[model samples]
Target: MNEIKAMEKPIKFSDPLFVTLVASICCLLWGSAYPFIKLGYSAFDILAEDIPSKFVFAGYRFILAGLLLLFLFRVMSKRKFNLSGKQFSSLILLGVFQTGLQYMFFYVGVANTTGVKGSIMNATTTFFSVVLAHFLYKNDKLSKNKVVGCLLGFIGVVIVNFHSNLLEFSFSLSGEGFVIIAALIFSITAIYAKHLTGSIDVLVITGISLFVGGLALTILGLLLGGRVTHFTLESTGILIYLVLLSSAAFCLWNLLLKYNKVGKVSVYNFLIPVFGALLSALFLGETIMELKNLIALLFVSIGIYMVNRVSSRKFSNTLES
Candidate 1:
């Protein structure tokens, strides 16, 4: 019995690494989205409107992505599409916070700010998740290691943002505030999603969330006087790319979260800014200013190490207390 238990332990621990790899790939795909969005906005600006709006781009992409996921879900599962009253309400709330509000603020923020800045801002999702999980989910308690990790990660965020041309410490506050709020919304989504694991199939949950969120965005777009007539071939291509990649990433991410600790999975978000900056530089020819960028990379790397290291029995016991 003792020998069998010892053998089982290794498999149990190894399982999480596969999930982590999948989640990391998802983050990489999401990180690629920054440059595509930049290009799409530029193309739309030339062909459609003067303001270079993200509303039109985000609205179309999400709606299309949601519809695609719905079709896929129907084909793959013969299970009846039913939700309990409680589950239904939770799905609606998840849609509002996770998909609708989060994307809206993100799109608006990205539209106003540079891609590099936007990517760095999104890193706050992990830090905020640590804080939110401490208060919101009793199952996950904060330890000294987590506290130290978050502080280090946040310092990296500050360094990255400090290097951005868009960062103005003066009296004028504009897009930066919006982006920060967007990051907070993402954190809220992570915390809120902990309640959803056993209630619904992850694909179903993702489909419903996307569908409702897409509808909300469509309505908000109309209310804000955003016209649908601006869709062009270039914008359409960009929209397709965003939808496909985002849907794939979203599905994979939810699947991963089921098998791994949320903090462990979320550590991949730190890689986004790194990949985003590098991709922007390579494809978009965006220049990297050295000093602050190096410092940001160093801190982000350290944070990832701190967050991912598996604590031994002693550390686990200390964390539980």
Candidate 2:
């Protein structure tokens, strides 16, 4: 009760420093998920071809994460879990787009493409979020700085994926194509979530949506004969890490969005791909020390700086005016 009251008190959610810290943490946690998920796959002996198994595995992680969050929040806030009919409906929509459909496409798309390519492709979510926010909200109109920052981030993604014959003019609808679709879904749902936060608790919204989406995935996976080869201590630890990541990342992200403009906060998403690629290299023993990687990081860093600098100036001007 005390803690909840303290949180409700004035805080620096709009301050550039606070937003950068929280949003960067959220993106980094999500970025680390790439390596952790890969480790989970290996630990469980889940083959890349076993798409159903991937779904089941993701389902368990998310469901457990959601439950853990709900329990923690209930205890901390000294409140019982309750939801209105409208909140429930909003959560269902969020689950459908943010988790169920997004992951369905992402898992399948990743299975068909190289991990490097997939990570780069997933960064498209940043672009989607910015564009969607511009159209969806009266206050979050598109700006030249936003466009330039996003373009630089996109260019960084491409640079990171640079290699001979990287864009060999061939496309698969279910592979790379589906990954882009997942990005679009995530972006749209993020905007929806921003709206929902106006009426519901952030923790409630995140936990319920995760649980609902995970349940849906679990049912689909079971019907498709998904199964893990092992449930050993190591694999269990990996699963726990994933659960923690999902809980922390989603919760923090929701809170951030609740208090901040989508475009300003969403641009940090570009860093996810940079972190994913670097972490994957560390954990999977893939190559990381490349000229392109360094250049990509530089570009991404600049993009983040540009986006936030413009946003902060606007905020400062608002205060003065």
Count of clashing residue pairs in every prediction: 0, 0
lDDT of 2 by residue, 1-321 (tens): 687555533246777888899888998899899889989999999988999999999999889988888887798887986788877888988986788889999999988887657777788899889888888889887888888888898888888777665766556878788899999999899889888888787788889888888888888888899986699999999999999999989988888888888999988988887777788888889987878778988998888887778778877887789
- All candidates' lDDT scores? 0.67, 0.85
Per-candidate TM equals: 0.80, 0.95
* TM-score: model 2 vs. ground truth: 0.95
| Candidate 1: stretches off by over 4 Å | 1-14, 46-53, 110-120, 155-168, 171-174, 228-233, 287-298, 311-321
Candidate with top lDDT is 2
Question: What are the per-residue Cα lDDT tens digits for candidate 1 across 108-148?
Answer: 67556665566666777887777676676564567766667
User: How many clashes in candidate 1?
Assistant: 0
- Could you give the C-alpha RMSD of every candidate to the true structure, in order shown? 5.8, 1.7
